[model samples]
Target: MYRIAFGTSGWRGILCEDFTFENVKVVTQAIADHVTAIGERDKGLIVAYDTRFMGERFAKETARVLAGSGIKAYFCKRDTPTPVVSFEILRRGAAGAINFTASHNPPEYNGIKFSPSWGGPALPETTGDIERRANEMLGEVCYRELALDEAARSGLLEEIDPRRTYLAELEKKVDFAAIAGLGTVAVNALYGTGRGYLDEPLTAHKVSVRTMNMHRDPYFGGFPPEPSEKYIQDFINLVKGDPAIRLGIATDGDADRFGIIDEDGTFIEPNYIIALLLDYLVRVRKMTGAVARSVATSHLVDAVARKHGIEVIETPVGFKYIGELISQDRIIIGGEESAGLTIKGHVPEKDGILACFLVAEMVAREGMSVKRLLERLYGEVGTFVTKRENITLSPELEAGYAAKQHQAPGEFAGLKVRETVTVDGSKFILEDGSWLLFRKSGTEPVVRLYGEASSAERLAAVMAAGKAFILG
Candidate 1:
């Protein structure tokens, strides 16, 4: 039971392991208690689930727990995207929400994500309290539960479909008019909850869309429902083979992270996408504001901000930090290298559907291919390349890192260390404007090495040096 710890996102664990129904009930009760303590129990909660196995059941159980606690549960009727759930939280002015999703994790895994009334991931302070209370109640099994019908009869459970309202909100955020002019787009939902949320909007806007893997699949087609390059190859191939398809977009299991493929079948890295969109938002849309990014993200965004004379807020690794900026209207856009992003005047939570639609709008309004647009941005802001790799840690290495004994070198990859930023990890900024960051994973015996340089070759060299430094 103590193994049910929260990570950067939430308390995720393998099904039938730490993520059992008993643990879910315990965590749900903890959340209910926390909400009640805050005097928001009357506001009710929006409960949703993704396409993972038993996600609906887990969500229903969560609602039962909330109902048993004398709180109302506004439950989603079908698998709902994370962003949609977040929007519903704000729309209904609910106390908060409990979402059953593991995001991009493998199918064997499922977890609960709790968002506060602000419609963003719960911050550390809130999650920490819930974690402590849940662990304290490990073997208690003292929770109230009500049947679905009874909860509804008692006016504690209300079924809802957030799609219509969520899509209406999205229309105001994305430039659907521009996207309607775009000839064709391909969407790969990865058998997650993004099918209707991402693909339907484009079709509704009169954009010709071809969708793949839109059906619900508990196995996620035998691959983790991550919208990264490795997992989205078939979608890339589909777009590449079709001459009419102008772009390829995809979302993870819960539709909060995005993956993009250019018209030429290039898998544009999320770092590049963030930079490109920052430039687009600033230069094209004339949206005036600073930007925020995680420390592990690329400095290309900084280059764009510098070019535009806009401020850049550097945050820790989690989107929660970035989301904080969005909530405060401090940034025009907030993004991470992990393909999560949300913009100002929107829910603070990451919205892959919105990200994908905005890219389409960029392509249409610019009247150029995504590759060309990227080249244009490079021509203006100069070129920047970034890479990341994970190195497995031995027991000794893990202990050394835990003790903070592993320090950045005076020089790396034949460059002098100009500065070091320790906001989230040891980010050594080299004299040549390159950087190497080493961050330890909370749940695994591995260190993530991030490198950014002026060119691909330099990025490779920096990554190699980072790997050598960590392994040594």
Candidate 2:
């Protein structure tokens, strides 16, 4: 039997391989046990899934396990976004939620994510307990499942659709009026659950919206359902060819990560978007609090916070750390370079739907395009460019890194390392204020190299030097 493991997000594995129906039942039973131990079985659990292959089947199976365990299951009637699940968990005062989604992973993969009653991703302590329980129950038929009809009859299962309620709450958080004045906008759901969560709201507000890949497609138009630059070329082309469109927005499979295209067809990186939103929230919206960002994010966020005289909390790469700060109401906004963010007063989970709509409002209120606003931001707080590359590691190299015997040089790309941070990985901060981070993937035999510098040319040099150091 495969030892069930959870990563920074959740437990993800290839379908029919490690993530089989039997494994899902085991994990669900473990979650049920955890919830019962906390005395929350009476409070019930929310169940949701994305638009992946057999997503509904997995979610129903999870509900069956919960029902058989004598826990109420507030099951979603359709595929839902991750943030929506988080919101529903808080709204219903449920014990927690189980989401069947691999996020942006390829179609062949599927996984389960558990969010606590606090409406954020489960932290290490919580996930560790669940993981231990799951592995112990593996290879044994330690689960009991009830039929859907029997579960419903016994009041252990109730179907629900939380979209309208979620969108109603969002009306207060986003300035739809400002977006309505911004002429036409384009949305690319990337064949995910973003259609009703993102584009529908704009259309309801009478904003002219052009949508692509809005319908559900398990294949995701033949690529992974990630809203990155390389995968969203069609959306970029649509924005560039159409002179009437003001902005182009896209979301990943779970609608938790975002991709943006400027009016001129330029793909604005998520690092810059996070910094821009932080600046806007502090200066324009008058929100006050510390800003939270992942260590892998750009230093430009630090520059903005410094300019505004606000504190900056830098956490490791996972959004859950940032979400912890959000849950405590300690930060005005928490974001990561991977296009995940959630603000204070919102569910303590990444909401790409909110992020996109807020950007539309930003453009409307500023009376400028996203590109122009970015220029204004650069004018205020210098300029920085960031890049990331992945390197596959050989067995020997992986062993060397795991042993901590292979150390990086004191200088790289002609810059002396001023300091090193071993928070999540090995980060070398250079004298020139540039930085490079080398971190290993938790699920794969690869290392990710992230760099940020004052210019694109300098960023390239830093990345090249980082590659050489890792390979050699």
lDDT of 1 by residue, 1-472 (tens): 2655888888899999788999999999999999998899999999999999999889999989999999999999999999999889988999989999999999999999999999899999999989988888888887789998999999999999999999999888888989989888999999999988888888888889989999999999999999998988899899889999899999999999999999878898999889989989988989988999999999989989999999999999989998888889899999999999999999999999999989988889999887898889889878888888889999988888856534557998899999889899889999999999888888889999899999989989888988888888
RMSD of 1: 1.1
Please, what is the whole-model Cα lDDT of each candidate in the order they appear? Answer: 0.91, 0.92
lDDT of predicted model 2: 0.92
Clashing pairs in 1: none
Clash-forming residue pairs, model 2: none
lDDT of 2 by residue, 301-384 (tens): 999999999999989988889988998999999999999999989989999999999899999999999989988989998999
> Which regions of candidate 1 deviate over 4 angstroms?
403-406
Predict model 1's lDDT versus the native: 0.91
Off by over 4 Å in 2: 403-406
